[model samples]
Target chain A: MNRKLISDQDLVNLYVSGQESALEELVGRHKSKIYTSIYLLVKDSYLAEDIFQDTFIKVINTLKAGKYNEEGKFLPWVLRIAHNLVIDHFRKEKRTPIVTNTDGFDIFEVLGFVEESIEDKMLREQGHNELRRLIQLLPEEQKEVLIMRHYGDLSFKEIADLTNVSINTALGRMRYALNNLRKMMNQKEYSYRQAM
Target chain B: MVQTFTQNDIIKALYHELPASEMVHLEEQLENDTEIQNNFEDLNVLKLKLDSLVLEPSMSVISSILDYSRSYKK
Candidate 1:
Protein backbone atom coordinates (compact mmCIF):
# COMPACT_ATOMS: atom_id res chain seq x y z
CA MET A 1 0.00 0.00 0.00
CA ASN A 2 1.29 3.43 -0.92
CA ARG A 3 1.82 5.16 2.42
CA LYS A 4 1.36 8.49 0.72
CA LEU A 5 -2.14 7.52 -0.34
CA ILE A 6 -3.18 6.66 3.20
CA SER A 7 -5.35 9.35 4.78
CA ASP A 8 -5.12 9.99 8.51
CA GLN A 9 -8.59 8.57 9.01
CA ASP A 10 -7.65 5.40 7.12
CA LEU A 11 -4.48 4.98 9.13
CA VAL A 12 -6.41 5.56 12.32
CA ASN A 13 -8.97 2.97 11.35
CA LEU A 14 -6.23 0.52 10.49
CA TYR A 15 -4.59 1.04 13.86
CA VAL A 16 -7.90 0.56 15.60
CA SER A 17 -8.40 -2.64 13.60
CA GLY A 18 -5.13 -4.15 15.00
CA GLN A 19 -2.51 -3.37 12.39
CA GLU A 20 0.66 -2.27 14.21
CA SER A 21 2.27 -0.83 11.10
CA ALA A 22 -0.66 1.49 10.67
CA LEU A 23 0.01 2.93 14.09
CA GLU A 24 3.68 3.37 13.24
CA GLU A 25 2.82 5.15 10.01
CA LEU A 26 0.47 7.48 11.80
CA VAL A 27 3.16 8.32 14.35
CA GLY A 28 5.68 8.93 11.59
CA ARG A 29 3.30 11.31 9.89
CA HIS A 30 2.65 13.53 12.90
CA LYS A 31 5.50 13.19 15.42
CA SER A 32 7.51 16.24 14.42
CA LYS A 33 4.62 18.66 14.50
CA ILE A 34 3.48 17.26 17.84
CA TYR A 35 6.93 17.36 19.34
CA THR A 36 7.54 20.86 18.04
CA SER A 37 4.28 22.07 19.56
CA ILE A 38 5.16 20.63 22.95
CA TYR A 39 8.73 21.85 22.74
CA LEU A 40 7.51 25.35 21.99
CA LEU A 41 5.67 25.37 25.29
CA VAL A 42 8.19 23.56 27.47
CA LYS A 43 11.35 25.03 25.91
CA ASP A 44 13.56 22.27 27.22
CA SER A 45 14.79 19.84 24.58
CA TYR A 46 15.26 16.81 26.85
CA LEU A 47 11.98 17.32 28.66
CA ALA A 48 10.17 17.99 25.39
CA GLU A 49 11.60 14.75 24.01
CA ASP A 50 10.31 12.82 27.03
CA ILE A 51 6.83 14.35 26.81
CA PHE A 52 6.74 13.64 23.08
CA GLN A 53 7.28 9.96 23.73
CA ASP A 54 4.72 9.95 26.54
CA THR A 55 2.14 11.50 24.20
CA PHE A 56 2.49 8.57 21.79
CA ILE A 57 2.33 6.11 24.67
CA LYS A 58 -0.92 7.69 25.85
CA VAL A 59 -2.29 7.54 22.32
CA ILE A 60 -1.40 3.86 22.02
CA ASN A 61 -3.06 3.00 25.31
CA THR A 62 -6.18 4.97 24.41
CA LEU A 63 -6.45 3.39 20.98
CA LYS A 64 -5.72 -0.17 22.13
CA ALA A 65 -8.17 0.14 25.01
CA GLY A 66 -10.87 1.19 22.55
CA LYS A 67 -11.35 4.48 24.36
CA TYR A 68 -10.32 6.68 21.44
CA ASN A 69 -13.23 8.29 19.70
CA GLU A 70 -12.61 10.24 16.55
CA GLU A 71 -14.50 13.27 17.73
CA GLY A 72 -12.39 16.03 16.21
CA LYS A 73 -9.43 15.95 13.81
CA PHE A 74 -6.69 13.48 14.77
CA LEU A 75 -3.86 16.02 14.74
CA PRO A 76 -5.63 18.30 17.16
CA TRP A 77 -6.44 15.36 19.37
CA VAL A 78 -2.76 14.47 19.46
CA LEU A 79 -1.85 18.12 20.01
CA ARG A 80 -4.29 18.41 22.88
CA ILE A 81 -2.61 15.45 24.51
CA ALA A 82 0.77 17.09 24.11
CA HIS A 83 -0.58 20.39 25.38
CA ASN A 84 -2.00 18.72 28.46
CA LEU A 85 1.30 16.96 29.10
CA VAL A 86 3.16 20.25 28.87
CA ILE A 87 0.68 21.80 31.26
CA ASP A 88 1.15 18.92 33.66
CA HIS A 89 4.89 19.23 33.35
CA PHE A 90 4.59 22.89 34.30
CA ARG A 91 2.35 22.10 37.23
CA LYS A 92 4.74 19.48 38.52
CA GLU A 93 7.75 21.74 38.16
CA LYS A 94 5.94 24.92 39.21
CA ARG A 95 7.60 26.68 36.28
CA THR A 96 6.49 30.25 35.75
CA PRO A 97 6.66 32.01 32.38
CA ILE A 98 6.37 29.03 30.07
CA VAL A 99 8.41 29.54 26.88
CA THR A 100 11.18 32.03 27.44
CA ASN A 101 13.54 33.16 24.63
CA THR A 102 16.60 32.80 26.85
CA ASP A 103 18.25 29.99 24.90
CA GLY A 104 19.49 30.15 21.27
CA PHE A 105 16.21 28.96 19.83
CA ASP A 106 15.59 32.20 18.02
CA ILE A 107 12.72 31.45 15.62
CA PHE A 108 14.29 33.79 13.09
CA GLU A 109 17.59 31.95 12.93
CA VAL A 110 15.85 28.66 12.39
CA LEU A 111 13.63 30.06 9.62
CA GLY A 112 16.58 31.80 7.99
CA PHE A 113 17.99 28.42 6.97
CA VAL A 114 14.81 27.44 5.11
CA GLU A 115 14.44 30.33 2.64
CA GLU A 116 15.77 30.11 -0.93
CA SER A 117 16.04 33.46 -2.64
CA ILE A 118 18.86 35.72 -1.46
CA GLU A 119 16.92 38.96 -1.14
CA ASP A 120 13.69 37.25 -0.14
CA LYS A 121 15.63 35.15 2.31
CA MET A 122 17.20 38.20 3.88
CA LEU A 123 13.82 39.90 4.07
CA ARG A 124 12.29 36.79 5.58
CA GLU A 125 15.06 36.62 8.18
CA GLN A 126 14.47 40.23 9.11
CA GLY A 127 10.74 39.66 9.10
CA HIS A 128 11.18 36.60 11.30
CA ASN A 129 13.21 38.58 13.86
CA GLU A 130 10.80 41.49 13.82
CA LEU A 131 7.81 39.18 14.08
CA ARG A 132 9.33 37.31 17.02
CA ARG A 133 10.01 40.56 18.81
CA LEU A 134 6.48 41.71 18.09
CA ILE A 135 4.98 38.43 19.29
CA GLN A 136 6.88 38.72 22.55
CA LEU A 137 5.29 42.10 23.07
CA LEU A 138 1.71 40.92 22.44
CA PRO A 139 -0.59 40.19 25.36
CA GLU A 140 -0.81 36.49 26.20
CA GLU A 141 -4.25 36.01 24.64
CA GLN A 142 -3.27 37.43 21.28
CA LYS A 143 0.02 35.53 21.34
CA GLU A 144 -1.72 32.21 21.99
CA VAL A 145 -4.17 32.78 19.13
CA LEU A 146 -1.33 33.66 16.74
CA ILE A 147 0.64 30.55 17.71
CA MET A 148 -2.30 28.16 17.57
CA ARG A 149 -3.73 29.51 14.33
CA HIS A 150 -0.54 30.01 12.34
CA TYR A 151 1.87 27.42 13.76
CA GLY A 152 -0.75 24.80 14.52
CA ASP A 153 -2.64 25.47 11.25
CA LEU A 154 -5.78 25.16 13.30
CA SER A 155 -8.92 26.82 11.97
CA PHE A 156 -10.27 29.73 13.96
CA LYS A 157 -13.29 27.60 14.84
CA GLU A 158 -11.04 24.81 16.07
CA ILE A 159 -8.97 27.29 18.05
CA ALA A 160 -12.11 28.73 19.62
CA ASP A 161 -13.23 25.25 20.54
CA LEU A 162 -9.81 24.40 22.00
CA THR A 163 -9.36 27.65 23.90
CA ASN A 164 -13.02 27.61 25.03
CA VAL A 165 -13.68 31.03 23.58
CA SER A 166 -16.30 32.14 21.08
CA ILE A 167 -15.38 31.97 17.38
CA ASN A 168 -15.69 35.76 17.23
CA THR A 169 -13.26 36.13 20.10
CA ALA A 170 -10.68 33.97 18.38
CA LEU A 171 -11.10 35.99 15.19
CA GLY A 172 -10.82 39.21 17.15
CA ARG A 173 -7.58 38.16 18.79
CA MET A 174 -6.03 37.33 15.43
CA ARG A 175 -7.22 40.67 14.13
CA TYR A 176 -5.71 42.47 17.08
CA ALA A 177 -2.46 40.57 16.66
CA LEU A 178 -2.13 41.58 13.01
CA ASN A 179 -3.10 45.16 13.61
CA ASN A 180 -0.54 45.30 16.38
CA LEU A 181 2.12 43.89 14.11
CA ARG A 182 1.27 46.38 11.39
CA LYS A 183 1.52 49.24 13.82
CA MET A 184 4.88 48.03 15.07
CA MET A 185 6.15 47.60 11.53
CA ASN A 186 5.12 51.14 10.59
CA GLN A 187 6.78 52.53 13.65
CA LYS A 188 9.99 50.60 12.99
CA GLU A 189 10.00 51.62 9.33
CA TYR A 190 9.46 55.24 10.20
CA SER A 191 12.30 55.13 12.68
CA TYR A 192 14.62 53.46 10.16
CA ARG A 193 13.71 55.97 7.43
CA GLN A 194 14.39 58.81 9.82
CA ALA A 195 17.73 57.26 10.81
CA MET A 196 18.72 57.00 7.13
CA MET B 1 -20.83 54.86 -0.82
CA VAL B 2 -17.15 54.15 -0.23
CA GLN B 3 -17.40 53.12 3.38
CA THR B 4 -14.04 52.40 4.96
CA PHE B 5 -13.36 49.13 6.66
CA THR B 6 -10.99 49.04 9.65
CA GLN B 7 -7.83 46.97 9.99
CA ASN B 8 -9.74 44.43 12.08
CA ASP B 9 -12.27 43.88 9.30
CA ILE B 10 -9.50 43.21 6.80
CA ILE B 11 -7.90 40.71 9.17
CA LYS B 12 -11.20 38.88 9.59
CA ALA B 13 -11.66 38.74 5.82
CA LEU B 14 -8.13 37.47 5.28
CA TYR B 15 -8.72 34.58 7.66
CA HIS B 16 -12.03 33.75 5.89
CA GLU B 17 -13.88 34.07 9.19
CA LEU B 18 -16.24 36.70 7.77
CA PRO B 19 -19.79 35.80 6.78
CA ALA B 20 -20.29 34.96 3.11
CA SER B 21 -22.10 38.22 2.34
CA GLU B 22 -19.54 40.31 4.17
CA MET B 23 -16.78 38.37 2.46
CA VAL B 24 -18.16 39.27 -0.95
CA HIS B 25 -18.48 42.90 0.07
CA LEU B 26 -14.92 42.92 1.36
CA GLU B 27 -13.62 41.32 -1.81
CA GLU B 28 -15.40 43.97 -3.87
CA GLN B 29 -13.91 46.68 -1.70
CA LEU B 30 -10.47 45.15 -2.01
CA GLU B 31 -10.73 45.34 -5.78
CA ASN B 32 -10.92 49.15 -5.74
CA ASP B 33 -9.26 50.19 -2.48
CA THR B 34 -5.48 50.25 -2.81
CA GLU B 35 -5.00 50.85 0.89
CA ILE B 36 -7.09 47.81 1.72
CA GLN B 37 -5.25 45.82 -0.93
CA ASN B 38 -1.92 46.85 0.55
CA ASN B 39 -3.06 45.89 4.00
CA PHE B 40 -4.20 42.51 2.67
CA GLU B 41 -0.83 41.91 1.05
CA ASP B 42 1.03 42.89 4.21
CA LEU B 43 -1.14 40.59 6.29
CA ASN B 44 -0.48 37.78 3.83
CA VAL B 45 3.24 38.30 3.96
CA LEU B 46 3.13 38.37 7.72
CA LYS B 47 1.19 35.11 7.80
CA LEU B 48 3.65 33.41 5.46
CA LYS B 49 6.58 34.63 7.50
CA LEU B 50 4.96 33.32 10.65
CA ASP B 51 4.18 29.96 9.05
CA SER B 52 7.76 29.59 7.90
CA LEU B 53 8.93 30.03 11.45
CA VAL B 54 7.72 26.58 12.39
CA LEU B 55 10.68 24.22 12.97
CA GLU B 56 10.59 20.47 12.67
CA PRO B 57 11.69 18.56 15.75
CA SER B 58 15.15 17.01 15.62
CA MET B 59 15.49 13.50 14.18
CA SER B 60 16.50 12.12 17.56
CA VAL B 61 13.28 13.32 19.09
CA ILE B 62 11.39 11.43 16.39
CA SER B 63 13.46 8.29 16.97
CA SER B 64 12.89 8.38 20.72
CA ILE B 65 9.17 8.71 20.16
CA LEU B 66 9.12 5.69 17.87
CA ASP B 67 11.16 3.69 20.34
CA TYR B 68 8.82 4.65 23.13
CA SER B 69 5.80 3.67 21.06
CA ARG B 70 7.31 0.24 20.32
CA SER B 71 7.99 -0.37 23.98
CA TYR B 72 4.28 -0.18 24.80
CA LYS B 73 3.59 -3.63 23.31
CA LYS B 74 6.39 -5.33 25.24
Candidate 2:
Protein backbone atom coordinates (compact mmCIF):
# COMPACT_ATOMS: atom_id res chain seq x y z
CA MET A 1 0.00 0.00 0.00
CA ASN A 2 1.24 3.46 -0.89
CA ARG A 3 1.20 5.09 2.53
CA LYS A 4 2.61 8.13 0.84
CA LEU A 5 -0.71 8.89 -0.84
CA ILE A 6 -2.76 8.20 2.27
CA SER A 7 -4.38 11.20 3.89
CA ASP A 8 -4.32 11.36 7.68
CA GLN A 9 -8.06 10.81 7.70
CA ASP A 10 -7.62 7.74 5.53
CA LEU A 11 -4.89 6.46 7.82
CA VAL A 12 -7.16 6.96 10.81
CA ASN A 13 -9.88 5.00 9.08
CA LEU A 14 -7.44 2.20 8.39
CA TYR A 15 -6.26 2.10 12.00
CA VAL A 16 -9.81 2.03 13.29
CA SER A 17 -10.39 -0.92 10.96
CA GLY A 18 -7.49 -2.95 12.51
CA GLN A 19 -4.63 -1.98 10.19
CA GLU A 20 -2.02 -0.98 12.79
CA SER A 21 0.68 0.00 10.27
CA ALA A 22 -1.56 2.85 9.23
CA LEU A 23 -1.31 4.27 12.70
CA GLU A 24 2.47 3.91 12.62
CA GLU A 25 2.53 5.70 9.29
CA LEU A 26 0.38 8.40 10.76
CA VAL A 27 2.64 8.76 13.79
CA GLY A 28 5.79 8.82 11.67
CA ARG A 29 4.22 11.53 9.58
CA HIS A 30 3.60 13.84 12.51
CA LYS A 31 6.06 12.89 15.29
CA SER A 32 8.44 15.74 14.67
CA LYS A 33 5.94 18.56 14.94
CA ILE A 34 3.92 16.85 17.66
CA TYR A 35 6.92 15.91 19.78
CA THR A 36 8.46 19.31 19.31
CA SER A 37 5.27 20.94 20.53
CA ILE A 38 5.34 18.80 23.67
CA TYR A 39 9.07 19.33 24.30
CA LEU A 40 8.77 23.07 23.95
CA LEU A 41 6.14 23.27 26.65
CA VAL A 42 7.62 20.79 29.12
CA LYS A 43 11.31 21.62 28.49
CA ASP A 44 12.41 18.23 29.80
CA SER A 45 13.56 15.63 27.37
CA TYR A 46 12.51 12.73 29.57
CA LEU A 47 9.16 14.21 30.48
CA ALA A 48 8.55 15.23 26.91
CA GLU A 49 9.18 11.69 25.74
CA ASP A 50 6.78 10.29 28.31
CA ILE A 51 4.15 12.80 27.31
CA PHE A 52 4.75 12.00 23.65
CA GLN A 53 4.12 8.33 24.36
CA ASP A 54 1.05 9.16 26.40
CA THR A 55 -0.25 11.37 23.61
CA PHE A 56 -0.05 8.49 21.15
CA ILE A 57 -1.47 6.09 23.71
CA LYS A 58 -4.43 8.38 24.15
CA VAL A 59 -4.66 8.66 20.36
CA ILE A 60 -4.78 4.87 20.01
CA ASN A 61 -7.36 4.41 22.74
CA THR A 62 -9.49 7.17 21.33
CA LEU A 63 -9.45 5.60 17.89
CA LYS A 64 -10.00 2.10 19.21
CA ALA A 65 -12.90 3.24 21.29
CA GLY A 66 -14.43 4.95 18.25
CA LYS A 67 -14.28 8.34 19.93
CA TYR A 68 -12.14 10.00 17.27
CA ASN A 69 -14.59 12.37 15.63
CA GLU A 70 -12.06 14.74 14.13
CA GLU A 71 -12.45 13.95 10.45
CA GLY A 72 -9.77 16.25 9.05
CA LYS A 73 -8.20 17.71 12.14
CA PHE A 74 -6.08 14.84 13.41
CA LEU A 75 -2.88 16.81 13.98
CA PRO A 76 -4.66 19.55 15.85
CA TRP A 77 -6.60 17.01 17.85
CA VAL A 78 -3.46 15.18 18.91
CA LEU A 79 -1.74 18.46 19.58
CA ARG A 80 -4.63 19.57 21.76
CA ILE A 81 -4.36 16.37 23.72
CA ALA A 82 -0.65 16.91 24.19
CA HIS A 83 -1.23 20.53 25.10
CA ASN A 84 -3.86 19.67 27.65
CA LEU A 85 -1.68 16.96 29.13
CA VAL A 86 1.14 19.44 29.56
CA ILE A 87 -1.24 21.84 31.27
CA ASP A 88 -2.50 19.09 33.50
CA HIS A 89 1.04 18.09 34.39
CA PHE A 90 1.94 21.59 35.46
CA ARG A 91 -1.30 21.99 37.33
CA LYS A 92 -0.71 18.83 39.34
CA GLU A 93 2.90 19.70 40.02
CA LYS A 94 1.97 23.26 40.94
CA ARG A 95 4.84 24.50 38.86
CA THR A 96 5.10 26.53 35.68
CA PRO A 97 6.99 25.70 32.48
CA ILE A 98 10.62 25.22 33.50
CA VAL A 99 11.99 27.63 30.90
CA THR A 100 9.88 30.45 32.28
CA ASN A 101 12.29 30.82 35.19
CA THR A 102 15.33 28.74 34.36
CA ASP A 103 18.44 30.25 32.88
CA GLY A 104 19.48 27.42 30.58
CA PHE A 105 18.01 24.03 29.74
CA ASP A 106 19.86 21.56 27.58
CA ILE A 107 18.60 21.38 24.02
CA PHE A 108 17.59 17.79 23.47
CA GLU A 109 19.17 15.93 20.53
CA VAL A 110 16.94 16.28 17.46
CA LEU A 111 16.58 13.59 14.79
CA GLY A 112 15.11 15.46 11.84
CA PHE A 113 13.69 14.15 8.54
CA VAL A 114 16.70 15.27 6.52
CA GLU A 115 18.74 12.53 4.90
CA GLU A 116 21.97 13.39 6.67
CA SER A 117 23.76 11.21 9.21
CA ILE A 118 23.22 11.92 12.89
CA GLU A 119 26.57 13.67 13.32
CA ASP A 120 25.97 15.92 10.33
CA LYS A 121 22.45 16.72 11.45
CA MET A 122 23.67 17.66 14.92
CA LEU A 123 26.37 19.90 13.48
CA ARG A 124 23.82 21.62 11.23
CA GLU A 125 21.25 21.92 14.00
CA GLN A 126 23.78 23.62 16.29
CA GLY A 127 23.83 26.63 14.00
CA HIS A 128 20.11 27.18 14.60
CA ASN A 129 20.16 26.61 18.34
CA GLU A 130 20.39 30.30 19.01
CA LEU A 131 16.87 30.83 17.72
CA ARG A 132 15.53 28.05 19.92
CA ARG A 133 17.42 29.44 22.86
CA LEU A 134 15.95 32.88 22.31
CA ILE A 135 12.52 31.39 21.89
CA GLN A 136 12.96 29.89 25.31
CA LEU A 137 13.45 33.45 26.51
CA LEU A 138 9.93 34.40 25.61
CA PRO A 139 7.35 34.66 28.39
CA GLU A 140 5.15 31.59 28.82
CA GLU A 141 2.02 33.07 27.30
CA GLN A 142 3.86 34.41 24.26
CA LYS A 143 5.84 31.20 23.72
CA GLU A 144 2.69 29.08 24.00
CA VAL A 145 0.88 31.16 21.41
CA LEU A 146 3.89 31.27 19.09
CA ILE A 147 4.51 27.52 19.22
CA MET A 148 0.83 26.67 18.74
CA ARG A 149 0.69 28.94 15.73
CA HIS A 150 4.04 28.05 14.17
CA TYR A 151 4.64 24.40 15.01
CA GLY A 152 1.11 23.18 15.52
CA ASP A 153 -0.05 25.21 12.46
CA LEU A 154 -3.04 26.34 14.42
CA SER A 155 -4.55 29.65 13.40
CA PHE A 156 -4.91 32.53 15.82
CA LYS A 157 -8.60 31.80 16.27
CA GLU A 158 -7.91 28.13 16.98
CA ILE A 159 -5.18 29.12 19.36
CA ALA A 160 -7.56 31.52 21.11
CA ASP A 161 -10.14 28.78 21.44
CA LEU A 162 -7.63 26.19 22.66
CA THR A 163 -6.05 28.56 25.13
CA ASN A 164 -9.47 29.83 26.14
CA VAL A 165 -8.51 33.39 25.41
CA SER A 166 -10.12 35.96 23.18
CA ILE A 167 -8.88 36.23 19.61
CA ASN A 168 -7.28 39.57 20.35
CA THR A 169 -5.48 38.10 23.34
CA ALA A 170 -3.99 35.31 21.24
CA LEU A 171 -2.97 37.84 18.58
CA GLY A 172 -1.52 40.06 21.25
CA ARG A 173 0.61 37.20 22.62
CA MET A 174 2.04 36.52 19.16
CA ARG A 175 2.76 40.21 18.65
CA TYR A 176 4.63 40.39 21.89
CA ALA A 177 6.49 37.18 21.09
CA LEU A 178 7.76 38.59 17.79
CA ASN A 179 8.55 41.94 19.33
CA ASN A 180 10.63 40.30 22.05
CA LEU A 181 12.47 38.17 19.54
CA ARG A 182 13.32 41.25 17.54
CA LYS A 183 14.66 42.93 20.63
CA MET A 184 16.79 39.94 21.47
CA MET A 185 18.12 39.75 17.91
CA ASN A 186 18.98 43.43 17.88
CA GLN A 187 20.89 43.09 21.11
CA LYS A 188 22.76 40.02 19.88
CA GLU A 189 23.59 41.72 16.59
CA TYR A 190 24.77 44.80 18.45
CA SER A 191 27.08 42.70 20.60
CA TYR A 192 28.47 40.93 17.55
CA ARG A 193 29.03 44.19 15.73
CA GLN A 194 30.78 45.64 18.76
CA ALA A 195 33.08 42.61 18.90
CA MET A 196 33.80 43.07 15.18
CA MET B 1 -5.07 56.52 11.17
CA VAL B 2 -1.36 55.87 10.66
CA GLN B 3 -0.52 57.82 13.78
CA THR B 4 -2.72 55.59 15.92
CA PHE B 5 -1.54 52.35 14.35
CA THR B 6 0.68 50.51 16.86
CA GLN B 7 3.21 47.67 16.77
CA ASN B 8 0.47 45.13 17.46
CA ASP B 9 -1.32 46.23 14.32
CA ILE B 10 1.85 45.81 12.28
CA ILE B 11 2.47 42.37 13.80
CA LYS B 12 -1.11 41.35 13.09
CA ALA B 13 -0.78 42.53 9.52
CA LEU B 14 2.54 40.73 9.09
CA TYR B 15 1.15 37.45 10.44
CA HIS B 16 -2.13 37.74 8.42
CA GLU B 17 -4.10 37.81 11.65
CA LEU B 18 -5.61 41.23 10.95
CA PRO B 19 -9.25 41.34 9.80
CA ALA B 20 -10.14 42.48 6.29
CA SER B 21 -11.17 46.00 7.29
CA GLU B 22 -8.18 46.42 9.60
CA MET B 23 -5.96 44.93 6.93
CA VAL B 24 -7.12 47.48 4.39
CA HIS B 25 -6.53 50.23 6.90
CA LEU B 26 -3.05 48.91 7.78
CA GLU B 27 -2.06 48.49 4.14
CA GLU B 28 -2.80 52.16 3.59
CA GLN B 29 -0.69 53.07 6.61
CA LEU B 30 2.21 50.72 5.71
CA GLU B 31 2.42 52.31 2.25
CA ASN B 32 3.98 55.49 3.61
CA ASP B 33 5.21 54.58 7.11
CA THR B 34 8.89 53.61 7.00
CA GLU B 35 9.09 52.77 10.71
CA ILE B 36 6.14 50.42 10.57
CA GLN B 37 7.60 48.83 7.44
CA ASN B 38 10.91 48.45 9.21
CA ASN B 39 9.29 46.80 12.20
CA PHE B 40 7.35 44.41 9.99
CA GLU B 41 10.55 43.55 8.13
CA ASP B 42 12.33 42.80 11.41
CA LEU B 43 9.50 40.54 12.54
CA ASN B 44 9.68 38.69 9.24
CA VAL B 45 13.38 38.17 9.76
CA LEU B 46 12.76 36.73 13.21
CA LYS B 47 10.14 34.40 11.78
CA LEU B 48 12.65 33.22 9.20
CA LYS B 49 15.16 32.40 11.91
CA LEU B 50 12.53 30.43 13.76
CA ASP B 51 11.73 28.43 10.62
CA SER B 52 15.25 27.01 10.57
CA LEU B 53 14.52 24.99 13.69
CA VAL B 54 12.99 21.49 13.64
CA LEU B 55 12.78 19.75 17.02
CA GLU B 56 12.36 16.00 16.75
CA PRO B 57 11.44 13.54 19.42
CA SER B 58 14.13 11.22 20.72
CA MET B 59 14.59 7.95 18.89
CA SER B 60 14.08 6.00 22.09
CA VAL B 61 10.80 7.79 22.68
CA ILE B 62 9.58 7.00 19.20
CA SER B 63 10.52 3.37 19.79
CA SER B 64 8.62 3.44 23.03
CA ILE B 65 5.57 4.84 21.30
CA LEU B 66 5.80 2.17 18.61
CA ASP B 67 6.16 -0.57 21.15
CA TYR B 68 3.26 0.74 23.18
CA SER B 69 1.03 1.01 20.14
CA ARG B 70 1.81 -2.56 19.08
CA SER B 71 0.98 -3.94 22.51
CA TYR B 72 -2.19 -1.85 22.82
CA LYS B 73 -4.46 -4.11 20.74
CA LYS B 74 -4.96 -6.68 23.50
Q: Clashing pairs in model 2?
A: none
Models 1 onward score TM values of 0.79, 0.82
Cα lDDT tens digits for candidate 2, A98-189: 55323223545444445888897766666556677788889999999999988787878889899899988988899888878888878998
Q: For residues A133-152, what per-residue lDDT tens digits would candidate 1 score against the true structure?
A: 67777777887777676665
Off by over 4 Å in 2: A100-127, B1-33
lDDT accuracy of residue A51 in candidate 2: 89
lDDT of 2 by residue, B31-67 (tens): 7888877777777877766766666676677777778
Q: Which pairs clash in model 1? A: none
Task: Output the worst ten-in-a-row residue range by lDDT, candidate 2 chain A.
Answer: A100-109
lDDT of 1: 0.72
Model 1 spans with C-alpha error above 4 angstroms: A104-130, A194-196, B1-9, B17-22
